[model samples]
Target: MTGSITIALDAMGGDDGPRTVIGGAAIALHRRPDMRFVMFGEEAAVRPLLDAHPEVDKASTFHHCDITVRMDDKPSQALRRGRRHSSMWKAIEAVKTGEADVCVSAGNTGALMAMAKVCLHTLADIDRPAIAAIWPTMRGESVVLDVGATIGADSKLLVDFAVMGGAMVRALYGIERPTVGLLNIGVEEVKGLEEVRAAGRMMREHDMKSIDYRGFVEGDDVGRGTVDVVVTEGFSGNIALKMAEGTARQIGEYLRSAMRRTWMSRLGYLLARSAFEHLREKMDPSNSNGGIFLGLNGIVIKSHGGTDADGFASAVELGYDMVRSSLLQKIVNDLNRFHTSDVPAVPAEQ
Candidate 1:
């Protein structure tokens, strides 16, 4: 529609096969008629879906890829052997070859990450690519990094994560100088290990002056949206992210069911329905679709495992935004900003 913004989708990647993936692609195309998608999966699976819908026939095309990547497969296996047979692998390769601007999948995250890293590589100065999870804040949406990218890292890595993540919040959302926070057990400087403390100090006294390092914030500050970028180790960050999602879902469901229990409650629900819908959508991870694996040379986004058609649709939308935003160029530019020669030695905050 808009010339050609071809998205190579791994139809076999997620829990739902071609059906959900194809349906989601349709939804995305409908939302933006200018975009076209290439469904890469078994031809048998993709053909029927196309034959049934004229919109899909005219607007989208399917590229046959026979193999599907399993959730439990190893990363290397996904690249070498998976490529030999898997559609997801081929879909990723499509991006590398300029066949597609972005690739979307609801498959195994580790395998996807592995294949992407091997093929796309990481940006210079970026150690481990961090998974940036965009969350709802009182101030709007904020992004938390290493949501499951790296397990353990050094202080400098954390600092770099902060830089890339701050850039992400600014690029995706419009936070000019996003506030950065270190996720630690305590708020005091002396509370965390030397690595955490050192990173915090560097951020506080940072010379780049581009980042807004807000001393320290504990886990509770996450949902409240106190900071624009919350940086943490991958293990800790991932757990915190999952817990927050689970809590939001449970609370939303509980409230919805409770409101339907009585006639007066139902009436009240109708009166305050907009508020409930707003809160529910805000808390819904599926609405966010997929998250970008930052610091990578090419665009790589991961959709949740049990995501529905709507969820898959969100991933596609994010992929489009990633391309339009020129995130790869942004990451490279941000990293180059604090390079060895020209950077001013930002003083550590006292």
Candidate 2:
């Protein structure tokens, strides 16, 4: 792997625009000195921010583009208007041309994914692209895919997510043959949608070396870290992800309210302030901000548009880690190997 990594930024994509994007770049540069950034946006807005952070400015190259893909813009509208000129489009183009190791954007999800698919294209042997997120679990973290790339994945597509997520975990966690689980309603053999069950049986029946398929996993199993990788179709996976985020917020709110209800409780909170701080750090969404678009020829990370500089930094850091891990080449190699083998399907249930 290369010691130095270059990242392209869609400076105009996020809610707070260039300031948020550049601030995040500065924070990430502090952590990774070997990193470089190429910022695409209006020079008038971006240059001053870059100038404020001279260190980041020194490491960054600016490309002026005033056009931006609106947050409400449809995928088709973005493609038509943002084809070659918009900051988001140009940032993705940098990856397609090998100018950057990865592209980081806090943009509209549909627009970003649509542009990425058009620019980077899907890898060989992969039918549809999957979006993978680093889910914070009880056992540290697990990789979950198809978080909302496409809806209604078939059995083979689910298996594809397994392979892709396994490769991602292996790259990030340095684990060989990371355990894989298909997210289901229950762990029973006969439960869940037909596609999930079929995928589970296929993984169980096949002798795939890339991942250790660990059968079915429930929604609760995700945070419990039942497996290193969780595979589900887009619709369910997206809902699960949002629900988890909402649940985390609810728990935090409850904790704060309880801590302030009485003088005695307030004193107790003061005594346990450090522990609470640690818990907050652990639960911070910013610390785990990037959602990766896997199964593409290049790496594309979508950050939460409303997140602050710290959150955006987390996204940039994710992109850096992926580049350092040789993520693209690893996925390509895994797919090539997977396609070469004859993976037979499981028989129909009586």
Candidate 3:
């Protein structure tokens, strides 16, 4: 469990660079003493931070990727002209060669996706790789997918996405009998255009192995966690996710400002310190940092661009959880089950 798991971090590809990247790396290593981070970035900046920290066992164990791929680099050009020794590319290569089990990046989303899909390729029988994030709600969290991965997913492709997303929710969160939904404009069964209606109908009738394709869900129902998994094409999913994240930040800032208004309010905040901290930690976007690039041949999690040490730590823990959970094997088993017709309407957990 300790040495068995290796995670590649894109040390040079974040908003804050080494300050936040290495700072967060320290916290991540401190939290999980057993984990090993193969940091890939400018060695000069990264090594000093690792040298200062005694808790991080193998901090010097880094791969120097002198060329950093910027967030604004065009996806196609980045792949065409980007440095061969860049951290992002090396990280993906590590997973491909089995030197690492998972790769985590706070880099360019499009670039990372392209590198992964182009380098690692999609799993057999799977159409495309999708970026999925867990939306926390009253019940727990629901998986939302194609978060800007594929633009125009056909009806059959979305049906495959539903199954893939359902498998992801089950592997990552241990959700058995996970309900699947196709995100649409309206809640009614036949309100959407041909593809949406067709997807809904396929979800109902399609024998999607372990996935219990529940039905269609509306935009507002995503954060509500109405179903275990929400499936949609890349265009709609990305817009909804960005909007939700922006709203969370706005409200969080308001809460902080209101708490600092007066002496009395500040005193009240002190009294409720623990609860406040807990809420803040829970609501922090960094804590929800890891996004699984589902349907890929291997695991790759892309952290947010603004992620700090705490966010990186969360990503590392997620990487560990993914490794320990044996997600790839679970998905493999699911694929086998699908082909052998071992899956029922609600397939039992393996």
In model 1, the runs with Cα more than 4 Å from the true position are 1-4, 260-267, 270-275, 341-350
Those runs of model 2 whose alpha carbons end farther than 4 Å from true positions after fitting are none
- lDDT per residue, candidate 2, 1-350, as tens digits? 85689999999978998899999999999999999998899999998998899999999889999689999999999999999999999999999998999999999999999999998889887889999999999999999988999999999989988998988998899998999999999788878899999988888878888999989999999999999999999999999999999999999999999999999999999999999999999999999998999988899999998999999999999999988998888788887787788888676775
lDDT of each: 0.79, 0.92, 0.79
Q: How accurate is candidate 2 locally (lDDT)?
A: 0.92
Supply the global lDDT for candidate 3: 0.79
Model 1: per-residue Cα lDDT at residue 230: 93
Tens digits of per-residue lDDT for model 3 on 1-350?
44556777777777877666667767876776667777788888777777777566364358887777888998887787654678888888788888888888888888999999888999886787788886787678888888888887887667667777777777778888689888887777547756767777655655665888777888888877888989888998899898998898899899999999999999999999999899887787887787888888889988888887888778778877888788777777776666566322422222
Candidate 3: clashing pairs of residues:
24-309
Error of 3 at 299 (Å): 0.8
Candidate that would win on lDDT: 2
Per TM-score, the best of the predicted structures is: 2
TM-score of each: 0.89, 0.98, 0.89
